[model samples]
Target: MSQQRIETIQKWLKDQNAEFAFIQSKANLFYLTGFRCEPHERLISLFVFQDKEPFLVCPNMEKPLISQAGWAYPIIGYSDHENPWELINKYLSTYSFEQNIAAIEKEALSVARHEQLQNLFPTFTFVNCEQGIMEMRLIKNEDEIAILREAAKLADFGVEVGINAVKKGRTEMEILALIEYELKKKGIAEMSFGTLVLSGENTANPHGHPNTKQIKEGDFVLFDLGVVVEGYCSDITRTIILGQPTEQQEQIYSTVLKAQEETLHICREGTILGDLDRKARSIISNAGYGEYFPHRIGHGLGSEVHELPSLNETNNDRLQVGMTFTIEPGIYLPGVGGVRIEDDVLITKQGHECLTKFPKELQIIHS
Candidate 1:
C-alpha cells in the first residue's frame, strides 16, 4: 500500500474538517491502496480516517487477493449474503470520530448507494472529495511516468500491429481482431478502452465502432487504441491511408499532423492547458476545417484512460512538471474520411516528451 498517498488523502480530510473519506471508485481505491480489483456488482471501498488508521471493505472471497496485493491494513470482508453497509457500520462502531462530517466521491457514487450511505450515517454531512483526489492525481510521479512510458510503448506496438493488418478487402473487425490478438500474445490483458479501428467514411465518426465494412483502395483507416501496463494506461491515435490519397485527403491529413505536432512543441511546465487546445483549434480553423474538427484536443491519461485536467479551450489549469496527457488533432469530413494524429505527452521542467513514438508522417499504404 502507498502510505504516502493514503496520508495525502488523510491530510485532505483533516483540512476539510471531515472525520473520514469513503473512497468507492476502483481507480481511486487502487490509487490509494495499491490494490486493484474489478469487484463487479460487489462492495469494495476504502474508508480512511483523518486521525486514525484506515481500513478496507471488500467481498469476503477477495480477502486473500487483497493481502496478496500488499495491503497491510485492516480489512473488513463481507460475505454475499450480508449487507456490506451493516458490516461497515459495525466496523465503524469500533472507532470514534466526529460523526458530523465525511468526504465522499460525488461523481462515482450512485444515487442508490448514496441513500445506503445516508441510511448508515444519517447525521454525517458528506462533502465532495473527488476534486481533491483529481488534484492529487494530476501530477505524475517518477514511478508513474516510468510505467506510463512502458504502457506507451505497448500502445505503439498496438498501432504497428493495426497498420500491418491493414490490407485491401479486409473488414474493420478483421483488423481489430488481429490487433487485439497480437496484443494478447504480447501479454496485454486489458485495453484502456474499447479498441477503435475505423475505415473509410466510418472514420468521420469520432467514436465509431469496428464492423464488417471492408477496406478498399483510397480509404483512410484510423487506429485509436491503448493498453494497460502495471495499472497505468497509454492512449494513442494514428490515421493511415490505403493506396494513393486524393489531394483533399492529403490536405486533411497534413493539417491534423501539423496541428498535433505544433501543440506538442509548446508543452512545458508553465504552459496553459487550454492554450494547447486553442493552438490546435486555431490551426485547424485557419486551414478552413474548423467545423470538421470536433471534440477537445485531448483528455488526461493515467491509471484511468480519461481522468483529470481535461485539455479543452475552456480549462484554465496550467501544465506542471510531471503532468502527462494526450495532444491529438483531427479533421472529419462526412462522406470522405477523417485524420487524427495523437501522442501521449509528458510535461517536464525542460520541455515535453512524446511517449508514443510512432511516426506522425502520413503513411501511405500502397495496394
Candidate 2:
C-alpha cells in the first residue's frame, strides 16, 4: 500500500531522532501519498508523527478531490479565511505527542511558513528530511517503471508528430503546437516539461524558448520534448534536417549521435555514473567540439521530472539496477546550429533497455 511510504517516513524520523515531519514539497507529498495537486501559494502540506497516523492538510475546496484520489487517512481542510497553521496545532494536540523535536523538508517550506511554524512552537527543533526522502525516490519500483515505459511511447509519438510538421517556413511555435495538439488529442494530460522546438541558428541555444523563429530549407530543426502520464514522465530529444543536409551539418549530427551512442553502450549496472559523462565528453573533445558541449550528460527521472542520482563528472556513484535516467549528448556551434540526441533508459541486471525507441539515424524532413 502507498501508506507504507508514510511508514517509511516515520522510521526515517525515528532514525534521525525526530518525532514529527512536515512535508511541503508537492513531489514528496505525491510520492508518499497518491494524490497530487499544485496549491499555487496556498498552504498544502502533510503532517506525520512517528507513533501516530499521518494526516493530510490541504485547501478546503480540494478535500473531495483528494478523497477521490484514494487517500484513506485523516485529512484536515482549511478555508482561505482561516489560519491553517493554527488548525494544524489543534490537530497535533489530539495525537498527545510532543511536537518539540521534528524533521521537516526545509527545501520546500518557505521562510514565511517556517516563521509561522516557529511562532506556533517556539522551542521546536527542526532537522532536514530531504536526503532521506530523495534516497527513497532514487531507485524506482516496478510499477513506476511500467508507467514510465508507457509515457516514453507517447514521447516518441510527440517526436513523430513534430517531425511530420517540419517544413520550410514553419515557425518553431507552429511545430510545437502541432506536436502538443496531437498529443492532447491522444489523451496526454501535459508535457513533462515545456515542449522545445528550436530551428536553424536558434537550436544553438540549448535552453532557448520556442519563439517565432522560422525554419528554412537545409536548416537543422531540433525537437526536445516529453510527456507526463500517470504522474510518471518521459523525455526525448531528436534533431532533424529540413532538407538536403550540408556536409558540415551531417558531420556535426554524426558526431553528436556517436557521442550519445557511446555513452548509451556503457549504461549498465555497476558502471560509475561519472564514467558515462567522461566517455561522451572524451569523444566530443577529440572531435574538437568539447567547448560546444556545455551541460551535464543527463539526470535522474521518475515521478518527478528530475530526481537524485544526477549523471555528471563530479559524482562518483555507480549505476544500480532499477535506476533510470537520460543519456543525451550534443554540440552547439555558435551562429550555426546544434544537434542533441537523447533517450530515456533503465539500467538492468544484464544491461540497459531504451524507454524511448525512436530511430536516431539522422532523420531528414523534406522541404
**Candidate 2 overall lDDT versus native:** 0.89
For candidate 2, write residues 153-251 as lDDT tens digits: 999999999999888888999989999999999998778899999988888988889999788898888999999887888999999998898888898
Model 1 stretches astray by more than 4 angstroms:
none
**Each candidate: RMSD to true structure?**
1.0, 1.3
Residue 248, candidate 1: Cα error in Å is 0.3
lDDT of 2 at 259: 93
Highest-scoring model, TM-score = 1
Summarize candidate 1's per-residue lDDT along 57-117 as a digit string, tens digits. Answer: 9998999988887889999999989999998888777776655898999999989888998
Give the Å shift of residue 196 in candidate 1: 0.5
Model 2 stretches astray by more than 4 angstroms: 94-99
TM-score of each: 0.98, 0.97
Clashing pairs in 1: none
